[model samples]
Target chain A: MYGTNPFRELEALRREVDRLFEGVASPSKLRSAFLPGRSARSYPLINIQESGDDLTVEALAPGVDPASLEVAIEGGSLVIAGEKPRPAQNVSPEAWHRSERAAGRFLRKIKLSVPVDEENVTADYRNGVLTVKLQKADAAKPRRIAVNVA
Target chain B: MAENTVQKTNGSTAVVATETEATREPERFVTPPVDIYETAEGLTVVADLPGADPSAVDVNVEDSVLTLKAVVPEADESEAAYVEFRLASYFRQFTLGEKIDQERINAEYKNGVLTLLLPFAEKAKPRRITVKAA
Candidate 1:
């Protein structure tokens, strides 16, 4: 009864609908374009952002064993591989109530558009998210240009 | 005797989030995935809440309803040249029945996963009676 105003209600409803598709309309990641259904998409989805001097890669990989995680750069592609063990391995199957969380091994290789300095890479995992920072190779970095008038 | 059975409150809604509502407007939520299992002593629930600090995660149970919510620090993505998933708060809820022992519930958080233990009450556990013959 409180939200009875027709105009206000319509405004709220429109906002909700717009939100549902808000982030979805952004450009799809380059690697997912040819991917099939939702399930076919790679596990532990990642985001790559570029600043002036570094490229940051963030991977959503929860409950992954640190000892099992492997990150490496091969040529111009970045390889991220790891295992996500089942949260409860000792629990008997008969006692299960629900198992909606996905658990398994996953590996993703992303081709970098720009060369990266292989020696200055660092990666860390915290709060179930993995952040990897790589420095751009000197030659690939944006260079300041000067125009001289005689 | 309450048997402590668990059920999802809604398709994905069991939120008791005054704290979350108090935050800035237009905040989005992603439904975290979960796993539930039972044992002779009680039931255990595990949920995935990535990018949210352990201190920011909140778990509450009241009136036979269990709610889970986690807040992640906001990151500046406006300058991001490329984007994938956005960091958002995690939200989900479950309805607990008499089959669980509410008084003895315990919780644990690690690696962005929350595990809740809902023990069975004394009355709910099966008991065996002894028979004597003359």
Candidate 2:
């Protein structure tokens, strides 16, 4: 009698149908719910902004060690790599009611539209967010034009 | 009749204003992901709230309801070249049971993650009784 029960099979089928509908309703929510211990898309979500002479990129990453994070400018692209550690306290898997946070090594590469002064790039980590500020090349900065009165 | 109607409308408006002022609704918020685990000691909750300042984070328990809130600084969206995740404050809540020790709960925030240690109440903790030989 160590086998699947008929009632359990029916319950599984019902859940599958519910999940299908949920996916259609809110794809983002469903995607995250489906992947319990792993990221549905990318490891860290990012936002990139361009100011007068600097390109700033902020990466949202929680539970990641600052020392483990690595940022580098390769060719015309910026690369970010880091590892997120799992909870240190050991607990049996069965004791976990929910485990939604994903942990592992991740690498992301973003291509820059304009050239940057790689030598002057600076990075800082605070409150689980990594901010990278890249100084734009001298020629890449927007120049103001002056017109003489006619 | 017109005076009575005006008074009733004013009363309703006052009530609405008080309610809104008490709640102080936030413009935007995101539900942070969490992990709940049970241990021999008690229950542990780990929440991920990126870009939240540790000093601005708040955790409160009232009438068996646990509330978590964190304020995130606003970023300049006009100069954003690329965006993926939504930028918003973090807000979430959970209902606690009588078995939890509300007074002894502890919380820590580091690397954008908040960890809460909810120990079990004295009465709810497991105990063993000795049996004397008959």
Candidate 3:
């Protein structure tokens, strides 16, 4: 079972009363109005996994060439930067109701708990997928110990 | 075992070929591929949407829910291609927890990648504490 927030619930009752009393009460809009060139921060999407001795970080960067991408590790943070080129289409030069596609520069920064071996890190790009494998530090690896019962 | 023979003549290069299974067909429903990563701040999600411009992409958050929508333009009618792996786009959404700061969420699209920055709410972030002796 779910319950409504008491604050919002009270506000709703107030709005109902205002609507009943006021001759021209306007309902609050639910959707935000579209804005052009709004300030926004850039973040790159990534997939991370820990294998036996490696922490793999994969960032989906299709339409970008590996040569143009730069990957680096500073302190405990991994950074990936690259730019994507737009593709040419053969569509007619006419008006369209909607156009939605994103293209441009992208930068991603990730902090790792376990230190990574920068020298041994490897990155590969194939079929528009970029895969980066970082080898974990020796101290971060798990060790097992046998317990002796007295 | 099948061993095929190849012969070259007249300074012509002979082509050797071996047949293999056809590639997997594209998914019936167009679904974009997404990459998600957890960061110290919060989480980041990247989606692949070729031929999709920023205007065509839509991001919405309502009542702690995040949604992404886009459309993949259809292929040219005149051109013929041997193979294609692209697909259409629709909408994808995620229900977030208190960890996400909805007000500070931001996104950007460039090329074919859509990147979302989800910052963790200050109250929901993890903090380390020192041990005290009694």
Give one digit per residue, the lDDT tens place, for model 1 in B1-134: 11224333322222111223344346566567677877667778888888889889999887877888888767788657666666777777677667678889898887767889888788766678888887
- Where is model 2 more than 4 Å wrong at Cα? A1-40, B1-26, B130-134
Candidate 1 runs further than 4 Å off: A1-38, A147-150, B1-26, B130-134
DockQ of each: 0.35, 0.30, 0.04
Most accurate candidate by TM-score: 1
Colliding residue pairs in candidate 2 = none
lDDT string for model 2 (A1-150, tens) is 334698888888899999988646653553353233474576567789988998999887878888899999999899999988877458876566566678778888988999999899999998888999999999999899998999
| Model 3, docking class | incorrect
Supply every candidate's count of residue pairs whose N, Cα or C atoms clash at under 3 angstroms: 8, 0, 14
How much native contact recovery, as a fraction, does model 2 achieve?
0.79
> Which segments of candidate 3 are over 4 A away from where they belong?
A1-42, A89-98, B1-134
Least well predicted 10-residue stretch by lDDT in candidate 2 chain B: B10-19
TM-scores, chain A, per candidate: 0.73, 0.73, 0.63
